[model samples]
Target: MEPPNILSSIPFKQSPLNPGELNLTHYCMSFLLSIPWNDISVTGFEYLAKKYRLDVFSDTSNPNEVLLSLAGKIILIDVIIPTHGTYRDIRIALAFADATGEQYKNTGAEEILLSAIHENNTTLLERNVALLAMLDRCSPSVQQSCFQYLETLKSTFSLIYTSRLNTQAFNDETEIIMSAEGKPLNDNDGNLGLQLAFWKHQDFLYTAKISMNELPSNSLPCALYGSNLVAETPLKTSGEVSWLPETTMTQIPATMELLFEDYHIVFPEFGVQSLLDFLQITDLDLSENFLPYKTLLNLPNQTTAGYPSMNKSHIIYLGGIDIPSRSVHRIPYSHPRQILGIFQYVRQYLTLQTIFENVKLSSTRITATASLRLNLIMKQYPVIHIQYQELNKLSNVDPVIANVSVLPNGIVQLNSIACGNTPINEDTALKIQKMLQKTLNIGLVLEFAIPKLFNNQ
Candidate 1:
């Protein structure tokens, strides 16, 4: 018994432009063209595009529906404009829904378009209707191109008349955000095909092509990949390690259950405290005006500070972006990834202790379960917790925090930085022992006290 391959049996071959296919493809292309080039001019996107071979997705000969299938490989996407177009009269790949980025210009269609969303802005609506009519005549991809070129043109000509500008809006205890910094300039060809050209410099690189016949079904096992999860943590890196050898990828596989489906927290301004927590860092000598909280909280797509495509993988609060709380419900995907979180509090604790043993105490409350997660991740490594000790006076020795681990009488060793600016002195050691007694319920009872060193040396 011969069963037919459904796609093969139903011919899409009569013409790549058969009227039915043509209508759907053209309509889809129109919508695609409406949104092109991100409002932010990060060229790494094009570098990414070329790697994935997405430039071909715009080939006039290909069917537009192919895009709906190709959406799986994309983890993050930004659109300057968005439309609620359908493919073949069906909601295709609804999981990859879009949120439009409000157009980034002002005093023109850009302002009108953004304003129309919340109010009865008729002039903007009329202008947009005309824009849509022209958009309908085109393919979704070409429509995207229209906006992409518009961005370039604005960059070039607008700069001829304008001066350098700084657009930072929010700077507080909350976050740090980068700026447009420079004007974007591109050719008439637009940036799509030109994107993702270089290797090695990009965060992640790959290419893809879609054919209905070759598509994987929704049931296939897939894992989400996120690189430059900068908001998760930064390489404060008193030292540096090679990250691009792709060595960071653990054998951990797709089973590493993602807590979120996508991450769209842009300009991803993390608070100083939040940043410190995620990186498991001691307090830093940070300057001010560093980060900005983004505009994605229940924010509408394509609207100022937000867009539609932020899907479930997108988070509400980046770790250390706020106070650590196990009870902070998913009301906002607003929790730090717990496993790496413990070191935040512990690191600061150790640093303060090492520098100011028996000094004035600075008490801060951190949740406990996060420490459990951190311990789980780092359990493989041997650690010496010089432990916590309260200060009776500013003159009391601070706890030590550094990376060197040694056995008794082995060699000179350093403490982990989660404790102090300097190594523990003898009296400071007693304080640490006392603090541990009050904090943890169990541990090995080492019959030794810290030995004095610096003064003797």
Candidate 2:
């Protein structure tokens, strides 16, 4: 007889996780995300939107945003925190993670992970096992966590990679901050010295600053400026990508080096590091394989505690080499950066000599913002999307794309798109509009079918 699929039999449905196991994971993980590491807090995520203008999502109601990824795939979600406090907010995310499992479900040490959490005093055996298992899978996020928790799981986990990400619009601001702050970048206060400071880069409107001091109070070797201590889980085929580099650049930080080292260490079969060491890719290669990193370079625009809006700023990285941060040793990539002087050498400047190809505007007259057109968007839903129509006209794709577009005002939107170039008869179009209207009329019933006993939005 074939061996039993223990995973499918035990932890999943057959032998359901007990109540206590569920609660232990949920509460513990939630507490972990909120207080992952104290030393490196560049900006509370809330500061990004109201003050710094780092737009990560269009919606304003639910703030805490998380990038859920498995291997090379990345999914961004603006989390709905069930509670107001940090510990509670993280718990909401933890619940979501438990529900979605995602990349965390594939781990070989499922029971081991659960046992570790249960072994701790913080864990409560009386809690529901189903809830704990659910949280372990999806929501609270599998990236950043407290020192004790992270250290405990280090043996099995690959590495948590936290890359400071933003759009190209914030490039100027990113360059300014990187330039101002050198190797020991956290120099805000005088003689005693401040951790970091925020500066506005006129070159780029969405400007901000971060320093690494608060993260490591004493013996901690790792210190980051607004960057979270993410845990990079191991994937079978493709590893998750926080951000992939677009072009070939040099004087890069220890971001790649650390990733290469840690990733290879965790999954030696992948053979990622030996190649770099043997071929000395660090010194010889300059390919388009590297782009995203958070070594005091680009800041996560709206994902943290302080940021405001999403898509408000584009980010550009100048140049930075990995250096030693004596204050924090855990981060081998924590080094001084060389944004100005080395940029010209490490970066290839754009030098397009060709002229424009061809373009012509249709003679069709553009309509003004008449009351009729404006009211069309405000009829049922509070938003209107313009890009889908443009893309449909240009690429000739599906015309019925639900592009959620919002006006200058901030309001929850629930509605439909206007009739576009889709070859739909008047009858079908009307039917969809009517059906959608009916669903909305049901008082907005969104649910998970079965009754789940946990926090709800």
Candidate 3:
């Protein structure tokens, strides 16, 4: 007898939502509804129902649950509004463990709901809650619509409103697993512990373990928004990146290892220089707020930061709007992403040499042992300007391929440089060498390879 086929033994099953078996059980979602008992204007809800021509049906049996029929699909949502409050709106939150489950299966429900929220002119807190409830909760088919619409809404809203939206939205697709065991500094009798969180995406993985010096609960509600206590302060945190990415270099010896696709860089000894570099970068004044988040996350889901989704990815730190004096000097683990994102924006305005000088002087030694990662996915390489002194002008000194690395002592090492198959005399090589050294204070070691010009230039 022939061996049984394992695949054929199992029954093929799929949800009727899509013929290809659209499974969205993992897309858990939560909703928050803040209704001021005194001011319950149904205008926005009415406008949305009228505009979409959606049929609304209230569950007579259960007052909290309501059903909406849209495009031949039923969206049954359960919301419980509080009957009483002192001086603020009563807040109620609903969680959908399976966003695409039978009860609430419509693909475009989030878009419709967001439109309703926008029309209602809801309070900032309520609006933010509603927005968070919908992030990564919709079906794949409706992602673009929901994301683009949110982008539009973000543009029209206040800079501070929904501050966490972009950060949360950008990282929505990446799931994080965390474990915590800690006590705040104020609790003298308690033991101070650590919190570890891990997130892994396509090309890389990262783990951050941090210890909180101050409890978040201790943060005062300085910024009040829509009757909710939304604190604008960041908790004091000290942590280390226990994995790759090299974005947050470690201050502890052998605490982390950075592994690129082809190169492996190691760091020894404590170095707060990169963190200092980061702080200096963040201190620079930015004329426009929220530009980094908007520019990076608002684009279509097809790409990230103007590069293919596979080629580019990001991790963000939603730092507090107002940094407390006590937490200012503390190395807050949750600030790099936003800092890096902002750096991406302001880097263009600054001179290249300035950045290079800072990186070179940083005590955080970044020395590579393996070869350079050949699979570089940059959008475009900046033009290399080498002033040729007009001594014996040789044809524009064509683009060259080189392996670049920063030495353990901070000097940049540009080795195995190649300028196509062309053979050059000592004078030509010496000229190229002198120009590069003069401009970048870096020397080169040549290795021949094909030279290619990019961007049609």
Using all chains and alpha carbons, the TM-scores for the candidates as numbered come to 0.17, 0.17, 0.20
Ranking by lDDT: 3, 1, 2
Which predicted model would earn the best lDDT? 3
Which ten-residue region of model 3 has the weakest summed lDDT?
A: 252-261
| Tens-digit lDDT string for candidate 2 (161-204) | 11222323224434433332212221111111112212222232
Q: Rate the local accuracy (lDDT) of all candidates.
A: 0.24, 0.22, 0.25
Candidate 2 local Cα displacement, residue 421, angstroms = 29
Can you write out model 1's per-residue Cα lDDT over 1-457, one digit (the tens) per residue?
1111111112222235463343555455545544433221123223334433333122123333223222212111222212233211222111111225322322343333334423434333333433322222221333233233223324332332122221133242111101111122222111111111111111321111000111122221222122322222222233111122223322211111111111111112122345334433332113322322212222221111111222101111111222111110001111112212222222222222222121111232321111100010111222333332222222454532223232211111334333345545556554544433323211111111222222311
Q: Candidate 1: lDDT of 146?
A: 29
After superposition, which runs of candidate 3 have C-alpha atoms over 4 Å from their true positions? 1-39, 46-57, 60-77, 80-91, 98-121, 133-342, 347-457
lDDT of 2 at 395: 49
Model 3 gets an lDDT of 0.25
Over all chains combined, what TM-score does candidate 2 have? 0.17
Give RMSD to native, each candidate: 24.6, 26.0, 22.2
As a TM-score, model 1 comes out at 0.17
Q: Please give the clash total of every predicted structure, in order.
A: 66, 72, 0
Show where candidate 2 strays beyond 4 Å.
Answer: 1-27, 32-332, 338-457
Name the lDDT of candidate 1: 0.24
Report the C-alpha lDDT of model 3 over 1-457, residue by residue, as the tens digit: 2111111111233447785663344222101121221222233433333333334333335354333322212222332222342112322222222324423233334333343333443443243332333332221223122233233322322222223223332233232121111111110111111112132223443322222111122111111001111123211123211122333222211111111112111111012223334434232111211122112212221211111222212111111112111101122332222322222222221122221221122122223211211211112221222111111223544434444332221223333354434444555545545444334422111111111111112
